[model samples]
Target: MTDSSAPADPRPRSALPLLVAILALIVAGGALWVSYGNATKLAASKEHAAVAPPSDPAIEQIKETLSSLQQAVRGIQADQQRQAERVGDVQQGISIGCDPTEGLSTTGRAKVALGSTERAQHAG
Candidate 1:
């Protein structure tokens, strides 16, 4: 029942081995892709972990000054509110003008206008 003259099944038996090798290679490539993705996510998470300014003394001092200035702004805002409330019965809106170079502290005048309160709230 075997036709030995039919060109020996007309295909190389090594075809099976080649197919298996290709499949193995594809599986290995998928595993490598997954591993690389995980490694990238791990690296990105490490990079995103609450990075901040260096812990140098100068940086710490600057942070402290910023915090103090933020509190001062809150205090000033509260005072302004109180003043507004106290003069609610006045006939006209309050008008106070002074030189920018003389009326306010340099740092206060600079950052206070930049919504430092909101920025500090987030930086906290």
Candidate 2:
């Protein structure tokens, strides 16, 4: 009735945009698929790493060395404390025999006498 649609109007108006949209959608889907695959592969690698046991002997040796050093430090601290106690005991014993008015200045003698008195009080 309209001269066979005038040769189908030569070109469809919506064809080009529709083709572009379809292409864009395909590209987006491909990109998403690629990213998903990469993410899955990364997750699998992490899982494997988590499941694996520690394999380095040097790390274990270092841990053992650190523990030994800690023990040595504790022993050294105890020895220092014992030596300090012995020194304090010797000072108190010396203070008990010495006259506060001889050889030592007034302030020094007072400090030594006070230390001896405090040590005696604490010991008793």
Candidate 3:
């Protein structure tokens, strides 16, 4: 069939894929640039830390105060130990060789005495 009745069309094709590719490349480049900037900042901070910082008087004063507090605590512990030894000596001196009879009530003690007396009478 040879029907020559329609005209030739002259429209361009859609380039959506190419536009998306270019947008992705731009986004990737921006991300890389931000990452590089952060890396440089971290590097600069590390270099500053590597250098020696100036000594502050407040820190030295705090260190001295800490040492004094430690000394005071040690003194208090030594005093407490000496007092404990003295108390031990006093307790040992006051201790007597006797049976303890404080836990039983009066009724319990009477029952125990009556039972002992009845046992003695039966034995006799």
**In terms of TM-score, which candidate is strongest?**
2
Backbone clashes in each candidate structure, one number apiece? 0, 0, 0
Give the distance in Å from residue 25's predicted Cα in candidate 3 to where it truly belongs. Answer: 11
Tens-place lDDT digits, model 2, residues 41-81: 99999999889786699998999999999999999999999
**TM-score order of candidates, best first?**
2, 3, 1
Q: In model 2, which regions exceed 4 Å deviation? A: 1-14, 41-45, 48-53, 98-124
Candidate 1: residue 85 Cα off by (Å):
42
What TM-score, to 2 decimals, does candidate 3 have?
A: 0.43
Better model by TM-score: candidate 1 vs candidate 2? 2
Choose 1 or 3, whichever is better by lDDT.
3
How far off is residue 22 in model 3, in Å?
12
Q: Model-by-model lDDT, in order?
A: 0.72, 0.82, 0.78
lDDT of 3 at 12: 56
User: What are the models' TM-scores?
Assistant: 0.35, 0.53, 0.43
